[model samples]
Each structure stands twice: as structure tokens, then as C-alpha cells.
Target: MRVVHRLFEMLIPRRPVSHQAKDRDNLQDWKNYVYGRARSAWARGLPLYGSSFRFTIVYLCGDSPADIDNIIKPIQDALVGVVFSDDSLVSDVDSHRRFISDGIDLTNLPALLIEGALSGEECVYVAVDSAGPLGSYL
Candidate 1:
């Protein structure tokens, strides 16, 4: 009842949030944004509960000094039911949040958003692969 081989990647044109005071009120908005954007962009009929998947993510935090770990859970939770059946199925993972000026060239990444990159907008880039190549994603 799960996908054997698959890849789901998306670029959420928004900012990453955390449990910090400044982000608390916006958590709901953040979740809603991610879910709606991802769902609309998904071409597949429905999300499958994969046996296990490698989740790779890189979020642009614009200017805030948000903790990467704190930013990760909300993003993962947002993808639930949209990208996968549950976040527990995410066995392998690589995630990070940084400023747009981090100087990382993400052009080679399949999920890179050219508009976001060119406009220097904050966004969350995610890739879920059932093939399990966590290192390659990093």
C-alpha cells in the first residue's frame, strides 16, 4: 500500500518559522501556506504512505535567526498527508535553514525555484525520495 520508488519535491515561496515568540502566532499561517502551496503544486493524484523515505530540505530564513531544528518540525508536519501519509515515515533526512546569502548554489537541485533565487525571496525547498540518497541531497 506504499510507493516503492518515488520522489516528491516542492518549493514553498515563504519564510521558515520556529517556536520562538515572534513565530508562534504565525505558525498556523506557516503550516497553512506550506500545505496549500504543496497541494496545489502536486501533480500526483494522491500522496502515498511510503515504507520509508529520505527527506531533504533547505529553507531560506530571510533575516531572522531561527533555529534549524525548530524550523524543521513545522515543515515536516505541514507535509503530512500532502507529501506522505505521516512524518514518522521519514526515516532518512537532511534539513537546514539559512539566510539567502548563505552562498549555496542550489541550481543543480531538482526543486530549485528560479524566481525565488533571483528575487532573493524566502522559501522552503523540500525533496522527499523513497530511493534513499540522503547524502546526495545534502
Candidate 2:
């Protein structure tokens, strides 16, 4: 898949919230936190990306072993009306969880993730790219 342009990219300096958060209060807090961070980074109420997009989420952590799959939806839903208009617009997605302390193979990882691990912060690296093929035809 071709990435036309990066619509949004940020190394969120916090652990990603997993969809498995069954506690209502905790889930609400996570949603609020995501909204606050995303809203602040992006304009509060700007036009959302409407075309096909790709999401690449990397969870860099030392211990919290949440399923990578479970974490994706919450983050994606949290970005609704902020990053992209709808989930249906997502053409591709890549999600991964990597441990920092363990000798992670640095070859494939991006530089920022290495830096984050070195900094000792369990954070989420999220990037959204515009998928060119379908969008280009329009």
C-alpha cells in the first residue's frame, strides 16, 4: 500500500488504553485522556480526514502486556471526528506491542521508538497515513 501523505503522526507520551477496560470509570477516563491529548494536538473541531487511511500504532512498553489487537479499537474510536471521519475509511492498519527493556531488535523499529524506550516511558506511537490508491481515484 502506498502512503500519499502522513495525515497525523505523534508519539503519545502515555500508555495506550486497551478495549478490555471493563471498568466504566477507567474506560471513561481513558477516553477523556485520549480526547484531550488528540484535541490539543489537532485543532479542537477541524475537518476530519475523509479518504482511505492507514493507521500504524506501536505500543512501546516495559511490562504492561495488553493484547495489541484489543488496544487498537479504543484508540481508533477515540480519534473519531478528530483524526479521521469514520472507521470505515480505514483501508489498512498495523498494530504492535514491543518491550523496551528486553533486547528488542532495533533494526526494524523507527528511531523515535528507540528513544522512547531509552527514556523509559511506556508510550504509544501512533501514525496515520493517507492511503493513496483509493483516494487518488477520487
Best by lDDT: 2
Give candidate 1's error at residue 118 in angstroms: 1.9
Residues 1-138, model 1: lDDT tens digits: 333343777787776778553656688888888888879867776776758888777777667656777777887888888878898998887786667787657655453555456658887778787745555446
Which stretches of model 1 miss by more than 4 angstroms? 1-6, 20-25, 111-114, 131-138
Worst 10 contiguous positions by lDDT, candidate 2: 1-10
lDDT of each: 0.73, 0.74
Residue 50 of model 1 has an lDDT of 52
The TM-score of candidate 2 is 0.79
Clashes of each: 0, 0
lDDT computed for candidate 2: 0.74
lDDT of predicted model 1: 0.73
